[model samples]
Target: MGKPTGFLEYKREAPQKKDPFERTKNWQEFQLFMPEDKLRQQGARCMDCAIPFCQAGTTMAGSGEIGCPVYNLIPEWNDLVYRGKWREALDRLHKTNNFPEFTGRVCPAPCEGSCTVALNGDPVTIKSIEYHIVERGFQEGWIQPEPPKTRTGKHVAVVGSGPAGLAAAAQLNKAGHTVTVFERDDRIGGLLTYGIPDVKLANEVVERRVQLLEAEGITFKTEVEIGVDITAEELETSFDAVILATGATKPREVQAPGKELNGIHYAMDFLTANTKSLLNSQLADGEFISAKGKHVIVIGGGDTGADCITTSIRHGAASVIQFDINKQKGAMRSGDNVWPLYPIIHTVEDAHKEAMAVYGKDPRSYMLQTKAFFGNQDGQVTGLQTVEVTTELKNGQKIRTEIPGTERTWKADLILLAIGFTGPEQELLQQLGIETTSRTTVKAPYGKYTTSKPGIFAAGDNRRGQSLVVWAIHEGREAARECDRYLMGSTRLP
Candidate 1:
């Protein structure tokens, strides 16, 4: 270890965030980078635990406990950072994570939750250290495209340009296979480029990596739909193997009245158009669903809901409110959810903080479920009715029931449903004759990633259902190895 007893000497320090009031005025990222010395101190907080649970990547049965899904080499990189060997840290980071920058920015950091230090003290700022390491690598010219020395002369078509697709493309290209990525959208990055707001992850960051992938001989074909523009048969015929990294984009619909109203929309649709408009003309084009001067109501209190609330605030929304059916989590973890597991505790995110600063109150409400949307004569949403609900255990199953006489109505000119995605769209999977699980995810063995049909495989959100970007990257890397082995009878890719 670079500093023995460093954990005792230093307290955990995170990057400073720009003031919510000021940062909400624009779409730029608000997180300010910590100084090099402070970052090193943060790295020093990593204890030399005999069993480092931070990198274990374990999923305990029925506990909702998880470690890093990508199995990041946390201790190695933390030591490198503590020693001020950032270039070496970046190399170690890239060994497991193809896109550390993406994960560093958007991932919820389950690694920190499972940190050994987090049992009694604050966890080391692993995510911030990771972000700095990769960003420093790019700035110092330590990161560059490593094109394969010799071509395998085998072509692989990767459908979808999300994290999974990009990771698969990168790994397969490294193995000397000619890889081409197909994206239905005009941009190369699927979720990172569109679904996420610029305030959280800037488009330029995504562009930077896409450019590097291009430099490394990975071809990105944007605006090319697999089932629509090019038939599934064509892809199978043109490539040696096809990997389906298309994300789980089929949004879980809110089965409430007046869902077809004009002002109601899916969360992704609203977010996607906002980002596109922002990038295209700085919102001058007015091509997106504007929340300006509108009373916005977001249903579902996950990351997507948080994004919606923040975006609406940036658009100068009259008011914003987020509703969740689940009971609010406690301020601290319960006894059952002790150390080394992700704590089921309530915490304010950046969006919630900004909303508090702007609206003078937290915008999230628990145990409230939308009953119906009320609309005007023009069919635009005017308001929504919700009822307070309570949960009770019946036969070991938790069930929600509406509370009588607690129905309330609130004005809401705009409604964004952020309830989360159900699974991948069925068109492409059906066209390719690929089997699916009972949950509607593309059927593939746990590690093999092979579909029912030969020469076709699945990975990422499409295979695992909606999950974190880190999990997508993990799936992509693993699936690429499986595909490579299937095609060449052996694969050296890690």
Candidate 2:
């Protein structure tokens, strides 16, 4: 709990972000750090609710209904940070989450929504406070590698090097198990390394954490893909246990006429290429993909689409348009969308705001459906035919009906498909004889995290499908605890 009168004394204040015009021209993070004094004030706003829903991390019914996925001791840590006990606050944060810095930057802060203060006013800036605490911990040299003093003879193999795998590997190593992580890519940190752009998540943060894990005696093998170049049989024989964190990467595609056009690219391809190129040489040799002088059309209205929009603007696209199938949401909180639930309000994101600053208007159009893709003789995409559709809930089912006379055509040279991921890739799961759901996620009991194969566990996007990094970290920690118990008849890693 924070100061008894702190909620009344302090108003919520989040960190300031860089101006859109200046930020869009470069591939740097836009989030501004709050001054220590300001961050302390924000942390003090945490109220001592009799029933703290903020740390209750469950997704079933009213259980996971509020707060954070990692079930972080929000009130306690907030109080610690407010009292200027930065190291203690970091310890409290690490008790639940292995990586507060990652969550602090990218998590949507569902816990903030579940805050009592949010019922009437803005929630305490939990995410920003988290960012400040962890950043301070590093600055004060409190964050150091704590390798287990003793070693357990058992060994564990983690597939994929994303948040989940990285978290599990770190925790398992702390438990003194000889842990080795296998990443398919040339670099470690799965989506964090490739899929996400530098503007959102800088690569150095990921590399730093990974380096800590390395210093703690964990081994990372990059460019060694399991089930492809390496076989599951080899891994099963080599390691005592296997934890699969291969994320849900199979991108959802919008199939239409002329789908094979040269200019059409998966959002991941564009993002990954851009990030790799930037890191490799900052595109100095002119080897990076450029959206310059092109009319860009980004499909899918989720975060990925927003990323594509911003990237295109930064790359100097002539025009950019975002097509969303869902209806436009309200500008502010609605009657049905009360506090403690994520407010489903329409607002400009960093990318959208940047696009507007340059384009003079938001780039999204609601209720638009792509009818077909038009291509030129050189197999390059030229345009797309679209029809406006209205969404209605008919007989307990959501439906989309095309509106008459709303069909139109738009010019485009580049198209980025960002329709989100379907699920974990099926081919590898099938190869391992691990059962999967219709949604393509690994079939395992909730909380248990046990796969069909004994000594094999699955978590993160691989088990739950594409989700927030916080959720993935939560599952990774939970699964690691379970895996430890399975390995050694009992456990204390949680």
Candidate 3:
């Protein structure tokens, strides 16, 4: 420990965010970094426990099953930060996590939940410290492209170009294999570039990493639909090995009346178009969905729902409301949620806070289920019918039952479905003749990235359903190792 009494003397402090109302005016990041001394003090708050659960990366029994899936060296970086060794801190942060910049902004920080100090008091500001370390590295020119010393003469193809695909390509390139990333979209990043809003993660941040990757001898092929543009057989014949990192993007649909209305749209369609238009023309070309002066209703409260709410607010929506089927959680942790696990409690996110500020009230409603959609004469969505639901535990699963008399109607000019995704699209997998699980995900056993067919591997959401970016990176790294082993017999990748 850098200071034995540091945890006792210092309290956790996070970076400040811009005013909610003011920040919603633009699509820029709002977080401001902490001063060096204050950040060091926050780093000092790390307890450096004997068995640091923050980096356990295990699937324990209970709510927060996993901690840092990438197994970040939390204590070592914390101590380095406390000692003002920022360059060393950045080096340590990059050991396991390929993109700390992305996770620092988007990840929910399960590491904090598993922190030993969080049992009694606030956890260390690990995420903020991580962000600063990388940002500082970039500023000081410590981060640069390091090409492989020698080429392996083996070429590998990675499909997707999302977090998983990028990480896999990076590791494979480090192993001296010529790596090419295939992206269906016009841009490089699949989710990071388009799925996530720029207000949380700026395009510049993603572009910087992409530039570095390109400089490091990795090739990115965008607007190339592998199955359609080039046959899977051709791809297999061209490359020594193929890694499928395509994320789970098939959205779960709601079976409700008037589902085909003009104003009713999927969450990805809205988010993707808005981002594309913003980057292409700054919304000047009018190619994106317009929530301006419209009453918006976002279904399924989660991160995607929150993104919709915030995006609608920025578009000058007249009103915004979000719905969740599950009942609202308690303010404090429940009895079953003990220490060192992610607490099941109500928490406010940036979008929620922004919605409250702009709409003058919290825009979320719990225990409400959508029944049907009501449209106007023009066939555009005008309102929605909903019914209140009660949760009843049967056997071990929670069942939601709608109450008959609790039906109601609400005005909704635009409806965005923010429900989660199902699994990856089946066209590419079917074309490759790969097996899948009952859940429709690619049937790759846990830890082993090999698919049913030889020379083909699966990772990320394509293998393990929709998940966090950290887990995607982990899967990509492991899958690259397996792919390397398959090609060269023995591998040196970690």
- Clash count, one per candidate: 0, 2, 0
Error of 3 at 304 (Å): 0.5
Ranking by lDDT: 1, 3, 2
Q: After superposition, how far is residue 166 of candidate 2 from its true place, in Å?
A: 0.7
Per-model TM against the reference = 0.98, 0.96, 0.98
lDDT of each: 0.92, 0.87, 0.92
Alpha carbon lDDT at 188, candidate 3: 90
Candidate 1 lDDT, tens digit per residue, 215-300? Answer: 99999999999999999889899999999999999999888888999999999999999999999999999999999999999999
lDDT of 3 by residue, 137-162 (tens): 99999999999999999999999999
In Å, residue 34's CA in model 2 sits off its true spot by 1.3
Error of 3 at 260 (Å): 0.9
Could you tell me which 10 consecutive residues in candidate 1 have the lowest summed lDDT? 58-67
Worst 10 residues of 2 by lDDT: 57-66
Candidate 2 per-residue lDDT over residues 1-494, each given as its tens digit: 65888888987777999999999879998898788888778878888678777777755443234578888988898888788888899999889888988988878788887888878777888888888888888889999999999998999999999999998998899889999999988889898888778888899999988988999999999999899888988889999999999999999888778888899999988988888888988877666667999999999999888989888998999999999999899877777666566667787788888888999999999999899999888999999999999988777577989999999999999999999999998877877899989888999876889999999999899899888898889888888988999999999987
Off by over 4 Å in 1: 392-398
Q: In model 3, what is the error at residue 70, expressed in angstroms? A: 0.3
- Model 2, residue 483: distance off in Å is 0.8
